[model samples]
Target: MQLQILEVILWPKAAGLPPRRVPFEPGKVNVISGASKRGKSSVIPIVDYCLGSRLCAIPAGTIREACAWFGIRVQTSEGEKIFARREPGKQQSTDEMMLLEDSVLDVPTDTPKKNTTRQAVKHLLDRLAGLSNLGFDPEEPRSGFQGRPSFRDTLAFCFQPQNIVANPDVLYFRADTNEHREKVRTIFPYVLGATTAERLAKKWELENLLRELRRKERERAAHDTVSATWLANLQVWVTEARELGLLRGDALEATEETLIVALEKVLAAGEEGNGFSAQGTGASADEYAALQTEESKIVLDLSVARHRLNQITAVRGTVGYYKGALDSQAARLGVSRWLRTLSNDGARCPICDSAMTSSSGELEQLCDALATIENETHTVSMAPPVLDRDLVDVKSKLSLLEDQLKAVRIRKRAIESRSKAIREGEQTSARVARFLGRVEQALELFSARSAPGGLNEELEKLNDSIEDLRKSLSEQQYALKLDAATARVSKDITRIAAKLDVERKDAPARLDIKELTVGVRDDAGREDFLWHLGSGANWLSYHVAAILALHVFFLRQLHSPVPALIIFDQPSQVYFPQRLTRPTAQSEEDDIGDEDVASIRRFFEAMGKLAAHFKGKLQIIVLDHAGPDVWDQLEAVSLAEEWRGNDYLVPKDWLDILE
Candidate 1:
């Protein structure tokens, strides 16, 4: 797809400063190169922010504060469109953006805010760029990204920020984050026409199905761990109930439902009293009532005796505790007496390690406390024997009550035994019926705990389905297509690298498609990849060539969804320092050497050749500190005046504008 930025406009918040507009033409390398801090690097972020970047990456200073809105005019297959995003406020940028379907030649004095959201603009861009809305599930929960590929995802290849342009470890913008790197990897094959939208969707669906299947299998395994014990208990209960004739079935062969039915039958038999007679040899009602009354009186007497015994036992324990405490107190009193004697003889205080004197009053008080403890201990010792006597009496009373209660209960049980025989036989059906109800509930719970028999079968079917889809995907020849595309991109990179005269032995032959990198064969014959190339010049050259090659590959494919625009922010940094005030003259001490100058010239020459090769389809924008002299021989436009003196991408006058 063809996509080019026609112009980038920064609207002033106040009327005093006019809008700043940087214009561009198609089929040429547009260089916004000048001195440092002249808003040369800000262009990439401004255009990216207008293109629906989540955060407003524009620096938070005079330029951002002065601008009310950031806008970009782009030419796509859907014709010219202008997108404007309001400058983020102190709090945050609003989701809303302004969009004009037609060409925007000049900044509008009164552009009205519209209800179009950032998401809507993204969707529109996706459509205009011919990107398929291919949906997919995240590899795991809370991965922070899901759904279809967006136009913003494609920008990883198109835009190179200053931090990444010369960074060897990074290949794409914002790829510093793992998630962004994953997104780039996932969309790389699709963006290059190596895989179809349908195939990608199916692959994601199969992956989700497999994840679900594994989750269900884990649940089944967990259930099995607990269900074994439940099943064992169920079998034991079934056997016991069967032996008691509460369940009338062969428990071994019975299903849960059958066991439930047998249990119900047993309960019904209990309710009907199927095997008992009403008449039996038992005591009369008068005798039984007289025994019950006698048992009640004995029980009350036994309870009173036990309560008194408990109180005596508690008193004995307290007396023993007090006796031990009194003994300890006596020993302490002896120690105090010794200390007092020592103090009177001019001894040091043991506690404070100072000269001490024992007062007569204090000694007397200690003597009184010791005497009291002695008296209390003597009294407590006397009480224990009394408590023992009381305990003896209570125990005697308790023994008599137990004997009476036992005699009565024995007689009562003899009478109850005859009656119970008759009642139990008569009520067997009812008892069994209740037991059956309980067993039925237990069986239901057991069945619930058991894993569903179809779970494994269903999982197998899913696996089979996934396998079939995999086979179908394989039949689509993704690997072959990807290999072919990689070869083409590698060839293009080799050609571009050679044209730039990058110093590397066998650079073309060392391009590894699987690794997505180019290597340099050293004197030791060891291959060093782009990330390990050390020098900033080699890093910058490799990135420029690789990125341009991928774009070239995309342009050659009729159905590739990537846009035909490349934005490079400071590709000249490898040749000059970041803090360079301006382009240096030939005689300057810090001037770029001839070799570096020729490399920069060749870089622009390669860009021009690629632009012409694509027949006015590709757009290249370079934001750097290079002068017009470096690019004057090539068909490149230099926005040098825009960065001259106080003028910048956002004009100096605009900095004074405030809302």
Candidate 2:
């Protein structure tokens, strides 16, 4: 990827006043130099951040404030050209800040509040430029390679500031200290020759071994979990059976006897009869049958009797009642005549007082005359004639009906006698039938209780056998779980070994961390890289160098189209202490100072050579605060480009104001 940063402007974020801008050309190695507090290091990380490196420690406000101060704009490209610019306040710049191609701006930028220019550019590259392929995705931080970008991957474009004597792992500068001899050997493949590849393979082997062990543990855990469930269920069944006495060894006969006793108790409570005989007595059944037969006879007899009696009673009663009523009527009519005579006299009529009047004049005479006429008319009315002829005829018919009813009563008595005889004869059958029925019913009740419906004991035995088989299966499964875990660990170890290039001779059962080590070469005897190399800086450098060398060689073999630049921050921090050792007066000086210079010179020479080899295809940038002579030596290479210098400056107005 080719990047061109036009200019960066910084506002007064720290002690500095006002704002300033720095500019750089494309594909060039540029150095920014300044004293400690002048924002010299700011340029390195800002550019690094814009390029999608996650190592930057600078806060986002610093970039925003700086942009506001300098009125900055950036021009960049992915598949399409993009220009982005930002200014202070709520409204953000709509125009392209940087132009990848002269004709196209990268469309409209996301609103500033929603997305910052830095984030937008990162996303644009991830999609258009395949930045994700290179293990740097500013678009998404969580996704990508497992570890941070390594030393060899980023050596060319980034470096520490000048005059700082960091270790050679800084990528831009090399340390000559004797303590770093092994590291220098690893990074400079020429120093260790073909053996470096073997060293890398050794380190890979141990890592793979550890990875395999962990994988095995996980697999085992999963298998155990699955198998344990079945085992747990079996245990529960066994526990329940034991609690319910199913596990007791009593014979079926004994079990039946116990069940029979319980059944008898239940039957005694539910049944109506006393002992067997009480229960057996079908006498009630005979009695019910006899009663039913008797009732039928009685109903027939009653029907006949009732029909005859009803006819007779109707004739006799109707005749007598009507005759008496007519007689009474005649008597009432005679009494009524007597009453009329009394009414004719003027002392209030016996039946009605209104007929008597107290008037003394002609009105009283007229009222008395009207009363006498009314009484005479009432007395002269004839009584209704008695219907004696019809009554006499009905009395004759009633007498005939009464004689018929007497004959029916005699017939009913004969039927009742026959019914009673039949009832007495049937009682014996009922008693015998009831005894047999009770015995049959008792057998049915016992059968229902003893039998588990259609589920036979044979089937139950089969179920028990199946349960045993299932328990065995569960045990097998548990064993398989542990075996599978072992197998998984083995597979993982194999895979990681392939990746890490480590190996173990024995088919080990458990993990032995002490067996885990790092080294070069797949040779069987090799164990730890620490033992093979040295301690401190030398040891650390060797591993870092191996890592970088592996990457370079792998890329070359794959024929990948590598970027023109590589960037690395200070890596030697991990090994700086190792570079220090006990100092004898002269031995210390020679080791600490002179030896450091020689090592540094050698490191630069190696960098020059590597750069030359790839110079035909790419550009290289190295950043550092190393001695001036180092750059001078790098410049002597035939393929080297012109060096650019950088420094922080407060504008004249701010300087004057501060002063």
RMSD of each: 37.0, 49.7
What tens-digit string does per-residue lDDT give for candidate 2 at 1-659?
A: 32334454444433434345555433433333222334444444445443444334333443444343332233433222433333333433232233233432332222222234544554544333211121122223234232112332232222333322223222232222332332332233211122222233223333333343454455445545654553343344334333433234432232444544433333332333322233323654455456566556655655665665566556556655655554455544554444444455665654556654443244444445554543333222211102222332343344345434444543444334323333432223443334323433443433432365312432344355445544543546544554443344333333322322112323122211122122333346543443444333443333223333333342343122123443333222332323322222256443544544344434344444444554322332333333343334453232122122323334445434434
RMSD of 1: 37.0
Give the best candidate by lDDT. Answer: 1
User: Which candidate ranks first by TM-score, i.e. highest?
Assistant: 1
User: In angstroms, how far off is 79's CA in candidate 2?
Assistant: 9.9
lDDT (0-100) at residue 173 of candidate 2?
25
Residues 336-394 of candidate 1 have per-residue lDDT tens digits of: 66666777788887788876563656876787788677656644554553343355457
Per model, how many backbone clashes are there? 9, 32
In model 1, how large is the Cα lDDT of residue 96?
Answer: 70
Q: Report how far off residue 44 is in candidate 2 (Å).
A: 3.5
